[model samples]
Target: MIDSHAHLDLADFDHDRAELFNAMALKGINSALIPAISEQRWENQLAIAQQYHCYFALGIHPWYVPEDINASLVSLENMLAKHAANDRLVAVGECGLDKLKPDFDRQQQLLSGQLKIAINMEYPVILHGVKCHQELLSLLNRFPNPKGGVIHGFYGAPELASRYIELGYKLGIGGLLLNPKAKKLRKTITELDIKHFIIETDSPSMTPYNATEKRNTPLILPNVASEIANLQKKTTVFILERLNKNFSQLFELS
Candidate 1:
């Protein structure tokens, strides 16, 4: 399985980072996509991908946008250009709008800049939208026929999700599905085609309900797949197979 949106570089895994990778491998997690939240982590993210033989995405995250947004964007663009042909660099984000955070306008500007880069390079993106789906959809529509991407940790309604699907984006299903009380999201998932979805852990965050006291990891991906399968009334093997194919197609992975 591919853990499509895991922040494995976060300090949470500092002590057992290598062990975590082994655990993920043992649990059948074939690859993971570690996204950069800031320019500071871009090199570290790439190093982690190289060391672990996984994948990574480079973009300024909404929450971590710098004071000089333009300069930061310049840095991001330079980095993207430097790694334009790097096979491990699969996408252009972990970038998007977060209404709950400060400087909404700045966030939009940063995301727009990165989106332009992604679109120009024909690279898929890994987005993080919270309470700003409509605004995000608008920004996405600005580009004509942009390459597809994934909306990580999607908890929006079916209509919003369908809008993204229509725009050539896939929804990332994370630990949110583990909560039995997330009936609305579960129902939305049921209504959507499984092809429009991908499984992610968003690890070191979004800990599954079953792992109440522990930091989340790619090791929990099978349980995530099982829950998704249960929600879709499909078998676990079928869900895994479909998710693998979807991940491969979305990231152009082998």
Candidate 2:
């Protein structure tokens, strides 16, 4: 299976990154999508992908937007052009709006710039939207016909999710499913078609409920899939197979 989103290059895994990749491979997670959050992390992300036989997306994250947004955009564009022929370069983000963060306007501007890059390159994006779904939708409406992308760590009502799916975007199902209090998100998952969702761990961030501590790893991806199957009243195998197809379609993986 493919982990649709994961920051495997984060310093949190510096000590055990290699060992964890081996564990993930044994757990049937053959590949992953490592997203770059800053210009500094792009090389490390690419190195991890090259070593692990995975894929990556490069873009300036909203949280890491530099003071000179124009320079940051220029750097991002240059990186995209430089890696355009890299087989491991799969998408264009980990970039989107987050209302909770500072500089709301700047965040939108950075996100718009990256979205334009993704559109121009004909590459799908991996978005991160937190409490900015409506704003994101409005921005996405301008694109009209995008190459398709996924909204990572999605947690919201069915109607809101439908809006994204209608725009050729899939909702990423992550550790949020492990939360018993996520009634709204759980119900939304049950009502949506499996094709509209993809499995993700968001490792080193959204730890599953079964995890002993807050730290997350791709090893818990199966647990996420099992919970999804239970919520959908389907077998784990069925869920895995369907998600594999969804991953391939979303990222254009062979």
Candidate 3:
């Protein structure tokens, strides 16, 4: 199983990160998408991937767009160019627009810049579009068939959901759907073509509904998989296998 998205480099997991990785391995989730959030995180993320044999994504997140954004983005281009052929560098993001962020203008600029980067590099993106779905959809539509990317933590209407899939983008179904109260997302996810969906934990952030611990670990993947299974009226095994295939295709995992 691919975690599809996670931030294992964040300090929150300093204590049990290894144990959590071991637990995930034992759970048959042998790989994960470890997204880089900031310049401070690049070395740690690479070190963690070197240590754990996982994948890494490097891009400036929208929320953290700096005053000298060009410098940071240039750093990202250099990072990708240097490591593009490295098997461990799986995707081009943890990057995209975030309307909820404090600086919408900077976020939009950063998002467009990264989208261009992803297209140029031909790497799939772990996108982070939130309330700006329409804006993103419009951008994607500019290409009759864009290379496509994952809309991480997707929580949108069914019509908009279809619009993303129609645009060649895959929807990421994660912690949000675990809530029975989130009927709208649940229904939208259920109706989505399994081929166009990727299961993600977004661990260390969006924990399952009854999460008792403050730190969300990848070991809890089974619970999230179970929730998705229940929604699809299928077994956990079936869900994981299908999700695994979807993730492998998205990230070109072996």
Estimated TM-score for each candidate: 0.96, 0.97, 0.93
Q: In model 3, which range of ten residues has the least summed lDDT?
A: 138-147
For candidate 1, which ten residues in a row score worst on lDDT?
139-148
Model 1 misses residue 143 by how many Å? Answer: 2.3
Question: What is candidate 3's lDDT per residue for 217-242, written digit by digit as tens?
Answer: 77677777887787778888888888
Query: When superposed on Cα atoms, how far off is each prediction in RMSD?
Result: 1.2, 1.1, 1.7
Please give the lDDT score at residue 251 for candidate 1.
Answer: 90
89-124, model 1: which lDDT tens digit per residue? 989889999999999999999998888888888888
Please give the TM-score that candidate 1 achieves against the real structure: 0.96
Task: Please list the residue runs of candidate 1 whose C-alpha ends up more than 4 Å from where it truly belongs after superposition.
Answer: none
Stretches of candidate 3 exceeding 4 Å from the true structure: 143-145
Query: Cα lDDT for residue 180, model 1?
Result: 88
lDDT (10s digit) by residue, model 2, range 98-157: 998999999999988888989988899889999888899998888654678999999898
